[model samples]
Target: MKKLFQTSSLVSVLNVSDYTVALTWYSAWLSKPDETPMDGMAEWRIADNAWLQLDATAETVKPSAAIIGVNDLAACRTVLLEAGIAVGEIQDWEVVLSCDLHDLDGNKISLAQIISQQ
Candidate 1:
């Protein structure tokens, strides 16, 4: 039997009614205002080489969307907060400091900084 595959990439899908504002807000966090927009969505290259996709629609995804691991969780949270976004409390996830936040479209995302090897 074929073995289950490993997840090579994580994608955060944000469904927004106004794609323009959504893209603008995310672009600020990314500090890549010059980056070209993708199809009907904007793709952000998060730390660890993951992708963040902002979609324009009314679709609602489960709150358990994604929890991404970053190199510096505190710094990421600071950057996001400085950009006027709400940064949730950080939880001790054993080996990581995990924090949760939502996108403009309300898709939940968790940001975690690993503190030890799993």
Candidate 2:
């Protein structure tokens, strides 16, 4: 049988206790304001089809994690640091380089730079 549907985009949600703080922090981290904003949520267009949504809630929520591929892990880390965001050490895993960063609510964002085979 033919497929009834096909996946197109991915939207990841991160729940936070404070919407304002999260929005500001994420905007700076992404270097762009949220493309969509609602009463208690904000969404950033990370790529052509990928989006990152921040949701505000009253209950304690566990931090969300997402892996974003970058062209230069070291440069990205430096930029984040200059922007005042704390970045973890970059790790070389034989096939890829990666680093982890946490948002204001402690949500983990893993940044990976794929090794290009020449």
Weakest 10 consecutive residues of candidate 1 by summed lDDT: 56-65
lDDT of each residue in 1-118, candidate 2, tens digit only:
9889999999988898888888788888776655656677888888899988888954777888988888999999999999888899999998999999888788999999999878
Best candidate, lDDT: 2
Models 1 onward score TM values of: 0.71, 0.87
Q: Could you tell me the lDDT of residue 29 within candidate 1?
A: 63
- The C-alpha lDDT values of all candidates are 0.71, 0.85
RMSD of each: 3.5, 2.2
Poorest lDDT segment (10 consecutive residues) of candidate 2: 31-40
Question: What's model 2's TM-score?
Answer: 0.87
Give the residue spans of candidate 2 off by over 4 A: 1-4
- TM-score (C-alpha) between model 1 and the true structure: 0.71
